[model samples]
Target chain A: MFSLQGYGPSILEGTYLTLEISFVSLFVAMLLGICGALAKLSGSPVLRAIAKLYTTVIRGIPDLVMMLLVFFGGQVIVNKVGPLFGYNEYIDINPFVAGASTIGFIFGAYMTETFRGAILAVGRGQLEAGYAYGMTGLQVFSRILLPQMVRHAIPGFGNNWLVLIKTTALVSIIGLDDMVRKAAMAAGATRMPFTFYVAVAINYLLITTVSIYLLKYLETRYSVGVRRE
Target chain B: MDFAIIASNIDIYLEGLKNTLILVSISLIFGLVMAIPLAVLRTSGNLYVQAPIRAFVYFFRGTPLLVQMFLVYYGFGQFEAMRESVLWPLFREAYFCALFTFALNTCAYTTEIIRGSIVATPHGEIEAARAAGMSTFLMLRRIVLPSAFRRALPAYSNEIIFMLHGSSLASVITIIDITGAARIVNSRYYSPWEAFLTAAVFYMAITFTIVFFVRKLEKLWQRHLMPLEQLDTKIEAPSI
Candidate 1:
C-alpha cells in the first residue's frame, strides 16, 4: 500500500494555499492588465510610454528574479520608506501577499498584451457603428466592444492562466509553504524525492487538464451565435 | 542606489555572467537541435510516432522546470542504482544537471513552436511540390522547413529569451550564475536593490540585444510578406 502518511494532510493544505494565491493573483493581474491595456490604447504619450516600459521590463526578466526582487527588495524599500513616515520599525511582508502581487504584476504585463490584442481584434467598424447610433464612449465600450473582445481574448487568456498557475510554484522559492516546498520537505524527510515530486507533477497535470476543459467551455460559451467555417 | 557596491563586485558579476552565458548557449543549441526532430515527429501523420512525442511534450510543459531540475539533480542522487550507473558521474555535477534539464525543458517548448508552424504549412505548396515530383525529403527540406522556420522565428525568439531567463534557475542548485552572484552579494552586503537590480539590468540588456537581432531576422525572412507597419501592431501574448 502506498501512503503519504502524515505528510498527506500538509500537502493538501499546501495545495489550498497554492490555489488561493493563484486565484487572487489572477484577479489582481486582470485589474492591472485591463488598466495597462487602456493606458497603451489611450491618447496620452506618457501613459503609452509607461505601459510599454512596464510590459517590456516585465517580459524581459525572469519571474523568479522578479519575485525575489519584490519580496526581499520591496521589503527593504518599504522598511526604508516607513521610517520616513515615522513608523521607524522594520516591516516584514507576508509571503502570500508578496507572492500574489509579484505573480499578478508579472502576468499583468502578459495580460496587457493579450487584452490589447483582443481589443484590436474587435472590429473598428463596430465602435464606429455604436458612435453612429449616438452611443457615448462608455456605452460603446460596454455595449459593443466588451462582448466581442471577450471572445477574442479567451484563447490568449486561457494560455496565460495555465502559465500563471504553473508560475505559482515559484512562490515556493520565496519560502511560501506551497505544495512544491511541502514535497521537498517530505522528500528530504522520507528520502523518497522521486515519489513526492512525481505526486506534485501529477497534481500539476490534473490542474492543467481541468483548466483545458474549462477553457474550452469558455471558448464555446463566448463563441455562441457566431457562425463558424 | 549604491554604485560603490556594484563597482566593487563587478568582477564577480562578470564571472557569473560568463557562467550564465555558457549555460544558456550550450542548452539552447542542444535544445534546438533536439526540438526539430521531436517537432517533425510531433506533426507526423503516423499516430504511433506522434503519441509518444505528445506525451513527452505534455509532461515537460505541464510540470514546473524547478521541480524537473530538482528531480534530475537531487532526486536521482537518492537512488543506489542511479549512483552505480555510468550516467551518475554526469548527473553528479550541478552545471551539467542544470544544462541537461534546461535543454530538455526548452526542447518541449521549441517543439511546439516548430510544430505549430509546420502544421500550418500551406497545402498548395505541398501540392505544388508533389506535382513537381519532389520526394518527401526534398519537399520538407526545400519548402516546408524553410517557411515553417521563418514563421517560427518570432515565437522561437521568445523561446530563446525565455531560456536565457530560465538559466537563472541554475542559481537555485548552487551554480554561480548571475542570480547566484546576486544572492551571494545580497547575503554579504545586505543590499538587495544593488544586487538583484544589477542582474535585472544585465538580463534586460541581453533581451534587447535578442529583440534587435530577431527583428532583423524577421525583416530578412518576411521581405515578401506583411509590411513592417502591420507586423508592428501584431502584439503576441507572453508565452511559457
Candidate 2:
C-alpha cells in the first residue's frame, strides 16, 4: 500500500501547475516557431541569419543552463532596469513566467526546425498554383500550405512536445512547485523518496502515453483523403 | 559583465569541467556497451523476448532524466533493504549515483536508436551472409552489427551530446559539475550572468566539439556512399 501521507492534495496541485506550465510554454513555442520558420524561409538574408543564430545557440546549450540564465539573469536585469524607471524598488520575476518563457524560448528552436521542414515538405508548386489562381500570399499560406504542412509537422511536433513535457521537470529546480518538487517535499517529510519519485514518474508516463495516443489520432485525422501504402 | 569573478574562479570551473568530462565519458562508454546486446534482443521476433526490453526502453525514455537521477541518488536510500545492501555505499555517493542513472538513461535511448538501424539493415546483406553458409550468430557479428553501427553513428552522436548536457543534473545532487560550479559562483558573487554565461560557453564548446568529431566520423564511415569522382579525388590527393 503506497500512501501519500496527507500530501495527495499538494501533489495534485503540483501536477496541475506542471500541466499549466507545459501548455503555456507549448503555446509560446508554437508562436515563436512559426515566426522563426518563416524568417528562416524568407528571402531576407538578415532575417535568415538571425533565425539561424537563434536555433544554433539554443540547440547547442543545455535547457537547464538556459532556464537558469533566463530565470536568475532575467531577475538581475529587470531589477537593474527598474531603478532607471520611476520605479526604484527591486522587482522579482515570477517563477511561473520565467520557467514557461525559458522553456518556450529553448524549444522554439526545435519547433522552428520542425516547422521549416514541414513547410518545405508542403511543396512549392502548390503555393505557386494558389498564386496562379490570383490568391494572395496569406490566402495561399492559410488555405493551402498550412493544411498540408500539418501532416508532415505532426511527427516532429509530437516529439518536441514529449521532450518539452519532460523538460518541465527543470522548472521544479527553479523553485516552481511542479510535481517533482512536490514529490521532493513529501519525500523529505516522510523519508519515502522512492515512493514519491516513482509516483511522479508514473504521472509523467500517463501524460506522455495519453499524448502519444492523441498525436496518433491527429496524424490520422490530418492524413485523411491522402493515400497511404 | 563581471570578468573579475570569472577570472578568479577559472580554477573552480576547470575542476567542474573535469568532473563533467569524467561523468559524460564513463556513462557514454558503458551505455553503448550495454545497448548493443539490448538492441539485438530488441530486434528479435519473439514477443516474450521483445516485451521486457520494450518495457525497459519505454520506462526510461518516457520519464525525465532529472527524476531518474533523483530516484537513484535519493530514492534508493529511502528503502531499508537498499540501505543495508552492499550497493548502498555506491548509491550514497552522488557521483556514482549520477553515473548509474545517466548510463541507464542513455543506454535506453541508444538501444532504441541501434534497434532501428538493426531492423533497417538491408535484407540482401542478410541473405548473402546466409548464402555464404554463415550461422546466425556469425552473420550478426560479421554482417549485421557492423552496418547497423555505421548507420547508428549519426543518431548515437546526438545521444552523446544529450548525455553530456544531462550530466549537468549531477550538480543538483551536489556533484559540482560545470553547472554546479556556476551555481556556486553565482551565489558567491551574485553575478548570475557571469557565472551561468561562462557555464553556457563551456557547454557550447563541448557540444560543437562533439558535432565536429561526429561529422568527421560520418564522413569517414560513409565514404563508400560518396560519388566516384569525389572518392577518386580523395584517394589521389595524397599521392599527387
Candidate 3:
C-alpha cells in the first residue's frame, strides 16, 4: 500500500537535483552576501545606502513573487534585448537557472544581514591587533575577520539554509522538476497523493535533520578554545 | 510597460488584496490561539505530554508549507475514507486547505518561539511568584505567560510577516490572493512587470505596516525596561 510504484529512481534523481539547486544557490547567495556585508560595513555612505536598499526591498517582498517576477520578467527583457543584438528569435530562460538565481538573489538579502551581524560581532581590538602586526588589509580580512565570523554566523546561516531548501520547492511551480514536482507527478499517475507527498515530506525531513546535526558539529568545531558560560 | 493593463485591473488587485489579508489574519489568529496551549504542553515535564506535541511541531516546521498544503489538498483526497468522511466538505475547498496548512505551520513556529521565551523567563521572577504563595496555575497565568508573550514579541513578529508572505501560496491552489491576481493579470496581458510589481508593492506596504505596529507594541509592552527619563515623557508639555 505504501510502495513508490517504480518511481523510486525518479524521486531519488529529483532529490539529487534539489540538493544541486540548493548548493548552487547557496554558493551564489554567499558571494552576494559577503559583498553586501562589506558594502554595508564600508565607510562609504553610497555603498551603505545601496546595501540597505537591496536588503529592505528583497526582504519585504515574498520569495514566490520575486521568483515569478524574475522568471517571467527576465524572459521578456532578454527577448526584447535580443532583437537589438540582431538575434530576434524567441529565447526562453532555463527554469533551472531562473530558479537557482532567484532563490540566491532573495536569500542574499538575508545572508547580508547574517554576515553583517557576524562581522560586527568580531571585536574592533582584534582587527586593530591584526593591523598592529602589519598585516595587509586582505590578510586581516581573511586571517582574522573571516574565521571568527563563522562561529557567529552559523546559527543564522543554518536557518537561512533550511528556509532556502524549502524555498526550492517553489521552483517546481515554474517547472523545475524538483522532488515536490516529482512527487506531484507520481501522485497524479498513482492516484495516491498521500503516499507520494508523505514520501516527499520524509525526504525533506531527512535532509533537514541531517543539516541540523552538521551545523551543530560546525558550531562546536568553530567554538573550540572559546569559553562558554 | 502597459500601465493600461494594471490600471484596468486595479479592482481585481484590490479583491486579491482582501483575500490575502483575510487568509493571513484568520490563520494568524487561529495559530496563536492554538499555539498557546501547545506551547505550554511542550514545556511540561512529562515525556508523554511533550513528545506528541514535539513530533507535531517537528513535522510541520520541518517540511515546506507548499508540501503541507498539498498534503492536505491533494493527499487527503487519495483516501476513500477521507472522501466519505464528514470533514471532506471542508477539506475539499482550497481556501480551507490553505488555511489549515498555514495555521498549523504558523502554530508550529509560534509554539517554538513561545517555548523559548517561556524557558528563558527569569528564575527570579518565578521564585518571587512562588514566594507570594501563588498556585502553579495562578503563577503561570499572572507571571510566566505575560512575560513570555512580551519576550516572544520580536520573534513572533517575524513569524507574522512570514505567514503573510506564505499566504501567497494560496494562489497556487486557486485562491485569488495577491499573487493569484498577479498571475491572472500576467497571463491575461502577458505583462509580468506591471502585474507582479503591483503585487510586490502591496506586499511591501503590508510588511512595513506589520513592522510599524509590532514596534509600537514592543515600546508599550517593554516600557518598564526603558530608562526613567524616557518613561511618561509623552505627557510632558512641549518645549517653548
In the range A18-122, model 2's lDDT, one tens digit per residue, is: 999999999999999999999999999999999999998986788898899999999999998888887887798999999999999988998999999999998
lDDT-based ranking? 3, 2, 1
TM-score of each: 0.94, 0.97, 0.97
- Model number with the top DockQ: 3
lDDT of each: 0.91, 0.94, 0.95
Question: Would candidate 2 be rated incorrect, acceptable, medium or high by CAPRI criteria?
Answer: high
**lDDT for A57 (candidate 2):** 93
lDDT of 2 at A149: 98
**Could you list the chain B TM-scores for each candidate?**
0.92, 0.95, 0.95
CA displacement after TM-score superposition, residue B1 of candidate 3 (Å): 2.3
* Model 2: residues with Cα > 4 Å off, grouped in runs: B232-240
Clashing pairs for model 3 are none
**Model 3: per-residue lDDT, tens digit, A129-212?**
999999999999999999999999999999999999989999999999999999999999999899999999999999999999
